[model samples]
Target: MRLGAIADDVTGACDLAGRVAEAGLPTTVLLPAPPAPGHPSPTTEHHEDVFAGGDDASACAVVALKVRTAPVGQAVDEATAAAQLLLDAGASLLYQKYCSTFDSTPAGNIGPIADALVALAGADGTVGTPATPGARRTQYEGILFADGVPLAESPMRDHPLTPMRDSSVVRLLAAQTAAPVSLVPWEAVQRGAAEVASAIGAGHTLVDALTEGDLDVIAAAILSAPRPVVAAGGAGVGTALARAAVAASGQRVDISRSQLPEVPVTGRLLLAGSASAATRAQTAAFAGERHTLDPLALATDDRALDRLRDALAARADHREPVLIGSAPEVARAQAELGAERAAALIEGALAELAAFAVHELGYSHLLVAGGETSGAVTARLGVQRLLVGQQVAPGVPWAVARSGEREIALLLKSGNFGGPGLFTDAWEVAP
Candidate 1:
């Protein structure tokens, strides 16, 4: 693998992988076990088999890690281990993927992990940007925005996991690391890559970007370097790099877009585990049977799992689509079950629901929302490998996975992805 990426969440990992694949590079998205502490080498006996399948040195390989919201110490160690595994796998280029909204608290895995990776690679410095305009997310003048509204004033302000109360990307990044931070405005980005890289070579930077063009310029500068650059950003940056490689090679690059198999879309189950305002809007507008998971019930009810079964059964009987989600009130959930336990409970419930639906009930397709939720459900279902297929919708693909003797198709969606009607439209047109 020439290019290796470490994403902080499962859904984000898939998105990052897809962006590179779309740029005509064969790709593999793997969930690897970080090497154990005191055992730095992946060849150690203590570590689980990591990156077992995809080892094509010419391809783009991504290792998905779930430390986006982990404690600082644990996140740093895990990220360092993951970096070593990719480096061992022959990846000369390393990119750390985070959310397009630049979601993270002042004390974070973002800044600290970037510092760790930069030091590990012995690179000049790291670059950070969360500007993915295709996802309707961008950063300008050090501030993050969704559509036209500032992130702090947007739906992300109420994010259940990492409530982004701050919009200044530079300030947000600076608070998390002692590294010297600088901001390159959009004008400098438009001035082209060399200037932008000159600014980044001095120290870590928050590059201003409002459109895909900005990313293209940034990618050109980053890739033009005499040696490999240690970079971290959203999926857009990865996409830019892949496309730049295609252009520089001066040959037709083979982009492996997933193709939908001739399978029917029956026995499909949709799990909405995100509490973002965008997710709430999409779930509410979904024209189907909806079962909102009660946080109070999941945290305290003795028969909560049974209740979930009953709700799913009723929906299954009607052959109507289903949406099971905890309400978007993160504060209520935090107060009721605590953030850590609350997320674990919700994800655990969704995982069980999905396993029963797919393994016991013989369901064939599953549409899941939320990065953490997707990670949990995929783990519970024993999905060790995935074959990325053509998207059912934008950023939502029909991916094939195996769970024992069963082959299941899953569509994993991040909380802030897709339009309000994305769910209904996906079901109406999928395999």
Candidate 2:
């Protein structure tokens, strides 16, 4: 594999994988194997041959892990194993993909996990940024900006899991890792890769990137640095990495796997579990039959699951697309059942609903929003890997995965990604 990406979440993995695929490199999203006998994380030895059935050399392999909100020690161990998996798969470049918003608590899964990957690669240092210009997320002067406003003042500050109250990337990362955190100013970056490389030292350096041009420069510098190239950033970096790899190796994207394939859009079902403003807007703008999941009802009532199943059955009978998600009153549910419990309840319920829509109802196309929810649904459906396909939005795509004997088309979207019309417009563009 040319690029081995370790994403902190499932949607983020698909986001990065899609970017790589767009750059002419076939990409695969691999989920970690089931946990060992009594272990919580899968080891490198245990995950061998994970890429055996997928694209080998000249392709990108991304290991998606649901460790974005996991505890520190556990997150580090799991991310490190994924790093080892990519390295063992003969990936010369290792990219750590996280949310474009740099979602994390003061006690991080990002900082510590990046540190683990760095140590494992035995690299002198690394350059990192979360500037995905396509998503309107950029970094300048070491501060992260979303849609022209600082991240602290954005909607992400109200995020239930990892409320990003600080806009300074240097400070956010420095608070979680002992390594010296520094910045490579836009002045240096604009001068080209050599200037950026010269500013990079023996620690984590944050680079400024406000546009695609800046990303290409940064990617070039990272790829030409030295052996075992290790870098960390959002999906923007993944796109740049693929372009750089192709330029250096002269490998072309496998055309057969890059484009959308002919697939039936019958039995379409849209399941969303994110409380993000984008998803709420999408749910409201959707012009179709829909059902709202009530966390409180699901937690306390026995008939809630039955009602949801029945709703799916009705949708299946008509072969119509439906949007099913929890109400936007997550705070109220969290207040009553605690944050973790409420999240688990919703994720579990959505996973079960996805299984029913597929296995029981014969749904062929599944559109899922949110990271944890996508992870749960994929796990419940027993999907081991996903082949990157046509994109529906900036970071969301329609990929194919197998569950038993069924070929299911999945469109996994991050909560903060896509437009308000996504839930409705996605169907019009499906292959």
| Highest TM-score model number | 2
Backbone clash tally for model 1? 4
Tens digits of per-residue lDDT for model 1, 1-431: 26778888888878877667667765666765334578542222322333344433235666666788988887777778778877876777889888888889888789998888888888866775888887888888999888789999998886767888999988998898888888989999988888887777545777888888899988877776655568779888888888877777764344333354545545877899888766778888988777777767777787988888876666636245677787667668788778878888888899999988877767777889999999888878866555555554445655676777877777788887878887787766455
TM-score of every prediction relative to native = 0.89, 0.95
TM-score of 1: 0.89
Per-residue C-alpha lDDT of model 2 across residues 279-370, encoded as one tens digit per residue: 99999999888888888998889999899899778653545788898888889999999888899999999999999988988889889999
What overall lDDT, based on C-alpha atoms, would model 2 receive against the true structure? 0.85
Each candidate: RMSD:
3.3, 2.1
Off by over 4 Å in 1: 33-58, 226-228, 250-266, 313-320, 328-330, 428-431
